[model samples]
Target: MTTFDGLPPLRDVIQTHGLVAKKSLGQNFLLDLNLTSKIARLAGDLTKCDVLEVGPGPGGLTRGLLAEGARKVLAVEKDSRAMGPLSEISDVYPGRLEVINADALDINPLEQLTAPVRIVSNLPYNVGTELLIRWLTPPTWPPYWASLTLMFQREVANRIVAKPGNKTYGRLAILSQWRTTPRLVLELPPEAFSPPPKVHSAVVHFEALEKPRFEADAKVLERIVAAGFNQRRKMLRASLKGVKPEIEDDLRAAGIKPTDRAEQVSLEGWCALAREIAKT
Candidate 1:
């Protein structure tokens, strides 16, 4: 039994099930139960929350979430080989764990998750950024999850909680901060994983706000932000010129200078610009 959850130790489980982290699937299994539990704790109280976890490779974090008293966990695992190890976890946790063998991007987690959902995952590197974008850009406010606790490559993690004028600041920071309060909670070295990815990893915890921090049309905001950051080195006048015919006027109205670069604009300023551009 493992000390963290009283299930088998992860290394034993891995050897028993022949669970090798598949590079093709972007798998670098985090085998430390203690660390996984710590990551789960970062999600706050999970006793009543349904956790939606993606890429539960070998079920390390799955066990942690269950042990941490998550009301229920909907674990989406694309690798079928992991089902054996995951099944053993489900048996231990009983009804609290549900395993879905499918691509997380292909399925809608809301269909399986109950309200007050907390999305917690040691996300696969290949799909982490894409998944975060999808979660942040959902059609309506508050989307489906109450909070998001996800691990990403350190570089990507920095982008999530970055602020204006930072080199990492851009679309991710703006989009993340516009709707949720994101904080970088923990950092892990490469040695923390089974395969040990070359780069370090970090966990980001995001608490969803009832409403966007600032009001703006989602589509308009997305469009202009994309344009500005797509050519981040260029001044807004040059980069966002294609977004709206009267780009300079809109920038001024938003209290931003047309000469400002994308990274120079604050979230509030970007939202203001989105609103200004939407008026046209």
Candidate 2:
């Protein structure tokens, strides 16, 4: 079937280019144009938005973003095999889609793209979580991108938007929820991709907030969250021992009981703990 963007079908593109998914690179190409369009719409209005799409194997989602009215899309792919197919997309879109041959992990979009930007990608599994943390851990508030619409294995998706008391809640939960509002937009079976993965995948949208829930040093907050949840099963008094010497005093100052586990602490409590730890 012809796609809305008038490009060749994805399977044909893959076959023509011998673009088999790479296991070591965590590549799984989503050939379904309908689903890609669905993810594009979840980023809200994109008419004026410049999108940063990582791992666009065969340009399926890259086409979707353009079809959904994105002003421009910078498609970053590590593999050189896609250069031909993505080039076809750029010719059709005419300056709307720019293909960058590089590692998404090493490129910082904040320095590359203009404002009103959104990052949308069906991230390669190997680097997906690490990329999310990088986006979430920007040095300053009101990060460059307006939002992040990403796909990941369902397990990691659950951890991103997980609530404080949920079993999935941990450092990811605190880091994600503290800085942005993340919600699951769509869930797909493992069979959704060209070479289906072993587990299911889901798309999540994280809208950037103007500020975190409270003021705390980004590095300090990250350290505190990591330490608190490092031994989540242990009480705060024990788990946070290595983070700061006065663990009990920090917990008390945060209005939290030393016996509380990491999962039981709220965002507010974590911020307070961060501040307390900074009280040197």
- Which candidate gets the maximum lDDT versus the true structure? 1
The count of residue-pair clashes in candidate 2 stands at 0
- C-alpha RMSD in Å of predicted model 1 compared with the true structure: 1.0
What are the lDDT figures for the candidates, one per model?
Answer: 0.93, 0.90
lDDT tens readout by residue for model 1, 1-280 = 5375667888888899888888999999999998999999999999999999999989989999998999999999999989999998999889999999999999987878888899999999999999999999898887889899999999999999999989999899999999999999999999999989999999999999999999999999999999999999999999998987789999999999899999999999999999999987
Q: Model 2: per-residue lDDT, tens digit, 20-43?
A: 999988999998898888899998
Candidate 1 similarity to native, TM-score: 0.98
Please list all clashing residue pairs in model 1, or write none if there are none. Answer: none
Lowest-scoring 10 consecutive residues by lDDT in candidate 2? 106-115
Clashes of each: 0, 0
Off by over 4 Å in 2: none
Cα shift from native, residue 15, model 1 (Å): 1.4
